[model samples]
Target: KANNTLKEIAEILMASRSVLLFTHINMDGDTLGSSVALCIALRKLGKQAHILIEDDVAAFLRFLDKGYCTYDNHIIENPDICLCIDCGDVDRFRERKEKFFEGKQKGCIDHHVTTEPFADFNFIDPTASATGEIIYELLKELPVEVDKDIASAIFAAITTDTGNFQYSNTTKRTHLIAAELWDYGVDYNEISVELYQNNRLEKLLLQTKILEQITVFAGGEAAICGVTQEMLEETEGRMEETEGMVETLRDISGIELAIFVKEVSREKCKVSMRSKKYINVAEISQKLNGGGHARAAGCTVMKSYEDTKQEMMRLAEEYLKG
Candidate 1:
């Protein structure tokens, strides 16, 4: 299955002159980094490749777009092929789904277990640690060079998604890939500092607020942290700054499940879920009409922050019991 999909994707890339690429809406490191790497590889092959991202580049990830032209309806161009990376479903594109690249051929490369076969050609690998790993293999099959920039992008994707090689998803292949990227002069220390160490004053203030309101339930087995609109306004922080804040809850001793609920609007809240072990947050997220990995997952609730926190807490407790 893997070989056939790779061959098909290679054929499509070889035949097409213009290619349109996309990722998910929230724009995490894995999605953005993988998309940028692929775009660079395709352009090196003398093909016209453009990344059509719908959201603003997260503050931490803006460096990946340094020399690339990531489009967002500002610059429009029709392409012969459309490819989505790290996105599980077409609906994940949101309104941009109907607006961009009505191409003749469409494909997707994703690592999510619950990914739907929404594209004409699909490469879905649940065991892979990151979509960037799959893209790395695919790049070898294509007649393109894996230069330092592309290697750095792939490194960022793999490193961030694997929690700096600390997550359970890290495997032998994951390390081998990192080793290869390192050989390409990926500057591991610099990337690590940029991704994990650097933080703005606003982000620190927002983190303080989130930590202050954390509540632990189920006898410290479950915890919940919240970020309201008012907190964002007070700190002048953007929604993207809250990226890894939920993991801080999981770090607390005795906490098995951690939930972070951020108010995106008056009646809508985004919930991020993390588990130390055992709990399949993906299943819980699916029940709430969202999907992701077992240990790390997320969902959006159309309710007040209080209601969303209560609902997620209930689900976490139920899962913890079983």
Candidate 2:
């Protein structure tokens, strides 16, 4: 089933002259890496390709966007195709870029289990460890070569999404692909240092604040942590700096479910959930109008911090009981 879709997508890429690729908002390594890698590969195939992102690239990921990324309000004048990568839906695109889909041929390449087909050509595989894996397979079907830049982007994408091949999503194919990417001279050591070891003082201070407020429940089986706007201001931190905070909760010896809630606005809180075993965070996120992998998922609640935390805790308790 997916092979046919990939073939069709390949045909689209082969036929298009210009392509505009989009990543989801609050971009993560997987989405940014996959989009940028695809952009580079498409350009190598002699297509005019550009990557558009709604938010500023996270400091750690700026290396991937040296000259390939564009953040301006200007739109490409009548691009031949618009490819939304790693995004579950068109609504994930920024308001400015939403119109780019209206009169153009649209396609999507994603690896989310709950994603609906929103494009003319939709290729989704929930089993793939990362969207980058899907992009790699598609690149194989095309006539492009995986250069160093492309390999690095894909390596970062798959590595981060699979938690450096430690997450449950990692499979034989994931490792095989990683081996291929390494063979392309992806600078694995540098990438790991930059991604996992290079932490700013502000981020450490923010982590301290989050740790100070960490709560344990369900007899140490569940943990919850949070950060507010004040916490961000106090630590001189931006929201993007909170990327790996939830993992800290999951790493606790007795924790099976971890929740990290951040106050994005006065009346809104973004909740990130992680489960080490048994519990399915995706189902919990779905109940909150969001979706993701079973082990890692998120949702946004339009409520006060306390209210949102209470709601998520309630859901977590219910799911943990199952």
Residue 238 lDDT (model 2): 80
What are the per-residue Cα lDDT tens digits for candidate 1 across 139-201?
Answer: 988988799989999999999999999998999999999999988889998888889888898
- Model 2: per-residue Cα lDDT over 23-137, one tens digit each: 8887888998999899989888888888877688888888778687887535567788888888776766757455556527888789888787767778988899999999999
Which consecutive 10 residues in model 1 have the weakest lDDT in total?
A: 69-78
| Candidate of highest lDDT | 2
Q: Which TM-score value belongs to model 2?
A: 0.96
Off by over 4 Å in 1: 1-4, 67-69, 74-76
Model 2, which residues run further than 4 Å from truth? 1-4
TM-score against native, each model? 0.95, 0.96
